[model samples]
Target: MAFFLWLPALLLAALSEPAAASAGTSICNDTGALHQLAVTARTDGSWITQGWQALAPGDCTNPLPEGYQGRFFYFRAESPGYQFRDDSIRFCTKAGPFRAGGSGDCAARGYREQAFARARISTDSQKIPLSSRSQAAAAAPDTDAAGGTPYTAAVVLQGCSPEQEGAPAACRFVGGGMEIRATAGKQAAVPAFAFLMTLQQGAPLAVEGELISSFGSHGDLDLHSAALRQPNRHDRLLRQMQGRWVSAADPGDSFTLSGAVRQVSYRGSAMPPEFVSVLDTCHGAGTAGDFLLARDSERGTGLCYRIQSLGSDELTLIYLPRGTRLVYRRLPEG
Candidate 1:
C-alpha cells in the first residue's frame, strides 16, 4: 500500500535525543554489549535461533543501556515464547550473559522496566480484536466461514506526525499485537512479513512484534544482503535495463552486415549477424534480443554479444564488462 506524506504545515524539527537523558539499558544496539537474538521456525516443525550484538555508536565502551529499552538491535519474537524462549528479564540486568526461562509473553517472560534514557519498548495486546461482524461471522459454525488462514498483518503508524520521523522510527506492538487466523489443526503459526520501509535507504530498522513466519523469505534476505555489498552493480542494472530503446531499422528492410563477422539480413530477421557473448563478457550467455556484439581481431571468436536482456519481457540485463559496445535493436512489440 502507498501513502503520501501529508501533515499540517509545520516547521520540521531536527532529530534530538529524548527529552530526558536515559540511564537504563538497551539490548538492541549492535555493538552495545547486549546481544540481539533471532529465532526462526521452519515449516516442518523445526527451528533455528541465532544471536549476535550489533556495533555500538560513538564510544564502544560507553556503558550499555541498563534496562530493557532502546532501538539498538533487531528483536524477533513469535507467540511471545510458544516456539522460542523468553529472556528479556535476564537481558535487563545481566546485559551480557542471559538465559531464557521458558516460553512466555514479552512482559511475563521477564523484560526489565526502568526510567533510564531508553530507546523503544515492546508492547503486548493480548489478543487482536476483530470487528463484531467478523466475530459473528466467524462463529457461524463453519470453520471456513472465517477468513482462511493467510498471514495477515495490520500495520498502523502512530505518532506519524513529523515528531518521530528520522529517529529510527519504531514498530512496537500495538492493540494486543497482531491477530492471525490459522488453518485448523496446523501446528505452525503463519509468518507475517512485516518491516518498516523508511524514506532513508540504509537507515537502521528494528521490529518488536510477533508476526506470522511466512514473511521470512530467504530471497528478500539475499537480495538485501547483495544490495548492501555491490550497490552500484544493482543500480546500473536497474538503469540500463529500463532504457526505452528505439529500433534503428525495421527488420523487414534488406540489410547486409560488413563488420568483423558479416551476415546478411532481410526484413523481419530473428537473428543478428554480430553480437557479444554475455557469458564471456558478463554474467550469462548473450541471446538474440537486446544483445551487444563485439569481435576480437587476434582471437577467432566470430560473433558475440553481452546478454543485456533477460526475462519474459527482458527486464533483467547482462552488460559488457566495460569498454565494449554492441549495437542492436529490440523486436517491436506486436
Candidate 2:
C-alpha cells in the first residue's frame, strides 16, 4: 500500500486574513499503520527540507510551526520496511533528521533528490488527511494498458424472496426451474436447518440432484451458495463480470470489466483509470442477507457490496453507506 497526502492549498490572501493568520497546516494519520513524515517547502527563494518525524496511528503534528509562508508544501512519508516517496515534485533529502539549504544540484550538494507530494495549507487550520496506500488506491480509477474500456456492461441482482417465520426465506430454485429466489431485505438470524444450494442453468439432472443433496439438507439455506458456487467461485464471478456498466442516473460514471483477473476499471468525471484488482471474496457466517466481501488482491483492502438480488441476467447491488443502489443490464454478445 502507498501513502497519500491530501493537501488542499490555502490561498495566499487567505493567509493574511484573521482565519488564516491563526491557522497552520497539520497532518493527520488516518491509517492503521504507523508512518514517518518529512516535509519540504520554498520560502523567500530558499528551499528547506526537514524530516524523520515519526507518528503513530491516529497521531498528528502540531501545525508544523508554520516554518515557511508558502502556498504549497511538499511531503514524503513511508511505513517501516517500505520505500518512502512523494508526488512528482522532487527535492533533496537525507536519511535522517537534518536541514538542508537550496533545492537544486542535490547530488553535487551531498543531498539526495527525492520526489515529494504537494500539500496545500487550508485557511481554516484544517488538518491534511493522510491515508494508507490501500485506502488511497481504492479511491483511484482503473484503466487498461490499451487505454480502452475493459468491460461493456454491468448487472446487479434484482428481486429477493420475502421473509417467513422471522427466520428469513432461503434462496431456492423455483417456477419450474425458470426462476431463483435469493435472500433479500434486512439480515436474518442463522437458521437451525441452514443449508447451501446451487442450481446451474442446463445442468444434467444427475449433477443437479447431487448438488441439491450436498447443499440442501435442513429447511434453511445459505444464499451465498446459490450466488457464489465453490471451486472457482471468484473465477466464475470474473467471467460473469466481463462487460461494461454505466450508472443508471449518472451517464458520466461508468465501469469496464475485463480479463481473467477480478478487477474493475472505473472512468468518469472524477479521476483517471489506474487498474484495481479484485483480491478475494469472503462470505458471512450463516447470516441471512450477509454481505459479500470483495477485496483488492494487491493491498488486501476492498468493499462489501450487499447482494440484494441475483439472477442469471440481472444483479442488484446496494451500497449501504450512501444508500446507492446500482442495477446493471447485460449487453448482448456481439
Candidate 3:
C-alpha cells in the first residue's frame, strides 16, 4: 500500500539526535508510511518494554529516553492497514501509553503479548531504517546484459507462520540459503510472467539476504535452484513456451516454465522440474528445434523433444532419444 508523507510543522527539535554524546539508537521511518512503534530492551538490569511511539513517514525518533544503555533493543511496528512482521522475538504491549516491567505472563497483568523483532543498538547515534517497505527488492536487467527488454526479478516470501505460537527458532531457519541469478534493483518492474526476459546470458549475481532471498521463488528450495538455471537462448521459441503447458495426449499432465520451470505433474501426480531452460540447441537438433525441444541447460540431462506443431491450438513436443511424445496445449488461466 502507498502512503503519502506529511512533514510536521517546525519539527527540527524532535528529529535530531541529542547534542550530548549519545548512548541510544536512532530510528528513521524510511518506509514512507507511518508505523506505531513498541520496544523491549535490557535497561539497567531490568527488561523494560515501552510503546506507542508514533513514527510518521520520514520521521526519526530515539524511541528510548536518554540515559538508556544497551548493545541491543527490540521493537514491533504497525501501520493502520499494514503489519510489520518480526515475530522471532516476543515482548508485551498494551493499548494506550504502556510501560511493562517484565517479559513474563502478560494476561495475568492485563497486557497482551505480541511478537517483536530485535535490532542492534549502537553507542553512537547511527541511523537505522525501521523498514516495512514496498521497494523493488529485485534487480533490473538491461537489454544489452539480459539480451531482451529491460526487466526485474521479484518474489514474495512468507516466513512467519501466523499459526506459530511464541518465538520459535524454526521461524528463522531458512536453510543453508539460496542461489539466484537476479539481484535487487530499482528500474521499472517487470510482469511476473515476463521474468525470463530479464535474465542475463551470463552476468554477475550475488547471494544476498538469505531471501528466496539470500533469489529463490518465495524461498522454496526447488524454486531457488531453478532460478539459478540459465536459459540457453533468448529466442522467440523460448518466449512462446513461457506459460503452463499440458500434455495434449493427456490433459492431466502439465508443467510451467518461466524464470524457473515448476508445477510439473506426471499422470496427475506432482513432480519436480529438476533442471532449467528450454532451448533450441541443447539436444544437438541442428535445424533449431522447430522439430525438437530441449528441457535442460546441459545436453543429456533432461527430456528432449520433437516438435510437431506450435501456436494454433495443440502444441506437440515428442520426446526424442526416448521416442516419447508429450504434446501440449496451453492451459487457460482461471
Candidate 4:
C-alpha cells in the first residue's frame, strides 16, 4: 500500500458539503493508494457530514460544481484494512456514500460517531509531504515528453470503483477492459487523473495530452501520456485577468478570476474551475502567468489553459484537443 499524503489545496475543500452544486470542492489523494473520505461540515448555516469520496492514489474529487473558500472543512480517508481515525475530532459517518449531520446522539439518530481530521487550508504556498513509497513517483520527471495515444470523444472519470491495473491510462473500461493510452512520459497524468463526466454537451476540456473526452462520446482515453499542453506563447496573463469573465458563447456560463486566492470560480457549467492553488496575492509572483493562461502555482497538477489572445478587456482561449476557440469579455470588478 502506498502512502496517503494530503495536498494543502484539498485541506479546505471538505468544508460545508452543501447538498447542492454549491458544495464544490476539489481534494486530491496523491498518496499513491486508494482512500475513502468522509466529512462533517456546516453548509447553509447548518452542520452536515458527507462522505465516501473513494479517491484513488494520484486522483482528486470535486464533489461540488463550484469552488468555495471560507471556513475549514473536515474529512477522514480510509483504505482497505487501513485508515487514519482522528479520535479527537468525531463525526457521524455511514459505511457507504451519505450526507448527515446537525448535532445528534450517534446511537439515537441511528448513526455511528467517527473521528475526523480538521484540515487547515490556506491560500499560501505550503505543502505537507504525505508519505509515499511508489517507485513510479520517485522515477517520474516533473514534466516530460507526453502524448502517445490520440484521445477522441468519450470521457470516463475514475468511477465509484477505480481499478489499480496495468500502468494508468486516460480512460479504462468500466469493469475490466483494455486501457486507453493517451500520452507517454506524462508522469502526472497517470492513474491520478480523475475524468468526471461533467462536460456540458460537446464542451472541450483540453489538456496537454489531447484528451478530447466529453458527453455522448465513448472510447478509451489516455491521460498519463500527456502533461500540461504547451501553450503557444510562454507569456503570462497580460493585465492580469482578474474579475468576472462572461463567456461569449453563453453569458450564463461565466467564470471569475478571483484576486483573493488567485482562484477561478465558475457558474452554470459542468466543468469545474479551470485552476486552483494559486497565490492569494495578485502581485509579486514570477510563475503566476508563465503558462499563458495559468497553472497551479502550488502543485502544478490541475488543468491548465492555452491563450489565443488577451486584449485590455477580452480574453480568448483555445481548446486545443478539439480545436474549439472560446472568447470571454471581462466585466468590471466590483
Model with the higher lDDT, candidate 1 or 4: 4
Model 3, 192-293: lDDT tens per residue?
A: 213433443322121122222211111211122113333233334544665787765556567765433334665666553433334445343445655432
CA RMSD (A), model 4: 18.2
lDDT of each: 0.24, 0.43, 0.46, 0.41
> For residues 168-246, what per-residue lDDT tens digits would candidate 2 score against the true structure?
5544332110122334333442331133223333211110211111101111112322222333443355445556655
RMSD for all candidates, in order, please: 25.4, 22.0, 24.2, 18.2
Among the numbered candidates, top TM-score falls to 3
TM-score of 4: 0.31
Q: Which digits, one per residue and each the tens of the lDDT, describe model 4 over residues 36-123?
A: 5666666777778875554566655543314445467676665533435353677775433346876468647645666666655545
Among all windows of ten consecutive residues in candidate 4, which has the lowest summed lDDT? 172-181
Weakest 10 consecutive residues, lDDT, candidate 2? 209-218
Q: Give a tens-digit lDDT track for model 1, residues 50-124.
A: 222222221121122234233332233211112222234222211111233223342454332211111233342
Q: TM-score for each prediction?
A: 0.17, 0.32, 0.34, 0.31
Number of the top candidate by lDDT? 3
Name the weakest run of 10 consecutive residues (lDDT summed) in model 3.
1-10
